[model samples]
Target: MRYSIEEMQDAYDEINRKERPLVAFGGALGGALPAAALYFLFAQIGGIFLPMLLMPAAVIGIFARYTGFPYRLKPRIPIGILAMVFHFAGCWLLQLNPFVYLLGPVCAGVAISVSKVKLSRVQEFAIGRAEIGKLGPNKSIQPTAKASAD
Candidate 1:
């Protein structure tokens, strides 16, 4: 049975509301772990530039995952700005090279732009599952195979 758009939307909204807290925690943890590892690894090896190159990428990738693809400027701009602020602050505290300060916004922009190009299949599957769960199973319906052309 087909469900109305409103029904589907409500289901999605409900799911999002319920998952928001968990998603936020997961995003933060996911972003932080790799970044911390990279920072420590680079610090031990005396490689400052490598962490500058990779840390932002890790954080931005996790941010993109939680925020969804097809990034809109209105929503993402503030986030990008916030990330830049944090990056600059961290750099200042750590006494890192000033040149690397620019990497944060650049990485944020690239990640946001690339994310807009395509939605991941996993996201599509999750959305489909949510909709189907809302609509309930139709046991009466049976799958059928189409005849192949010889």
Candidate 2:
């Protein structure tokens, strides 16, 4: 079936506003965690650029949310790869321990790699799932036509 302009817009919007708990988790691990962990572990020495990994993670997160999909290594290939180098360099360059800053890109990438996100109720509705209404108005199973319409 063809999609109306409004429906198409809705779909685009849904894609634009997809869930991204992974990015949040990644950010926590890549940005805040490494900074705290490295600083703590090395007693405030500049560790690898572990925190830099959070940049890609953040980018991936925001992009994933926009596109309604998980991070793609192929699409973000260069940056994704460079993230690793940055992490390593941040540690050595900054004189921070590589192990301590291990929470950088690697952790963020892994975190984003395996995150699951559920669509919003509005999205479910737009995708043809019927709203049962507030306070559970109707929960009964109906005829195929009605069910199919929804």
Candidate 3:
């Protein structure tokens, strides 16, 4: 299956429109925590490394749920990267198996890419509104009409 450049560009634009820095950060942390938790859980299991299996799904789910799922490569890339970095940190600090460093991030990237999930229009609106809340009230702008009249 081949995709045209226009299709890719449109997807990028759509994703950019939905992006909120705070939401992205929240999503990143949301995904990261699970991987960290799972890593610890596996460590308790005598280094079974089974927690790695859940990393991809957790990354995909948390990110998509928290951030507006634009189904574009750009948005998912950051989530995957964040999740991977978190996973890597956990592994390195805990001294998990060497292979997990490679596997964890790769699996997250693949899962996010293949998920084909997207945000509904209402969900997108809600996320945007929530983002505004996180940004705090808009105190930067004053009433220009009054000043002009005065």
Candidate 4:
């Protein structure tokens, strides 16, 4: 069956809205750590501009790992681009020492991934809020009871 233009457009929009904001944040943060560390150390020996050199590699590596690797083998999806962006902000915007920058993301990822590490009740609530909703606005139009029973 053919879909009308409106149907297709609506479908396209729904998919776009559901995308999580965490991917870029995470990668940028991850990359920032290494970049900053290298930059700082190199700044001492090579100069200010030199140590910051590794930033590109960090960004690219994080992007490749989070965005590319998982998808290549199978399917690819991100929780939220927000996390990715946050991670980047922590590293670059915050100017965390490289070592310090690594701590937040590593710990944060582990806590979110393993489910063993404890988080505050409030913290858990915040994360839970981030979890995706199902059969909701971002999804395709589904038949209701009336539509289905007809």
Q: Which candidate is the best by TM-score?
A: 3
Total clashes, candidate 2?
Answer: 7
Model 1, TM vs. native = 0.46
TM-score of each: 0.46, 0.32, 0.53, 0.28
Q: For each candidate in the order shown, give its overall lDDT on alpha carbons.
A: 0.50, 0.44, 0.56, 0.40
- Model 2, position 148: C-alpha lDDT score: 58
Clashes of each: 0, 7, 0, 24
Q: Which 10 successive residues of model 1 have the least lDDT summed? A: 134-143
1-150 in candidate 1: lDDT tens per residue? 565545555544454454443344345445645655655555576646634654554475455456443223444444445445555655665567878776777755643453232334443444675556633233222346789999
For candidate 2, give the lDDT of residue 121: 49
lDDT of 4 at 53: 37
lDDT of 2 by residue, 36-103 (tens): 44434543543424454455345433444334353333433333443445455545645654465666
- Please give, for residues 15-119, the per-residue lDDT of candidate 4 as tens digits: 334333345335544555554565455435633442243343444345535532221111222322323344455357545557644444443343233212233
TM-score of 3: 0.53
User: What lDDT does candidate 2 reach at residue 144?
Assistant: 42
State which candidate, 1 or 4, has the greater TM-score. Answer: 1
Question: How many angstroms is residue 40 displaced in model 3 relative to the true structure, after the best TM-score fit?
Answer: 1.4
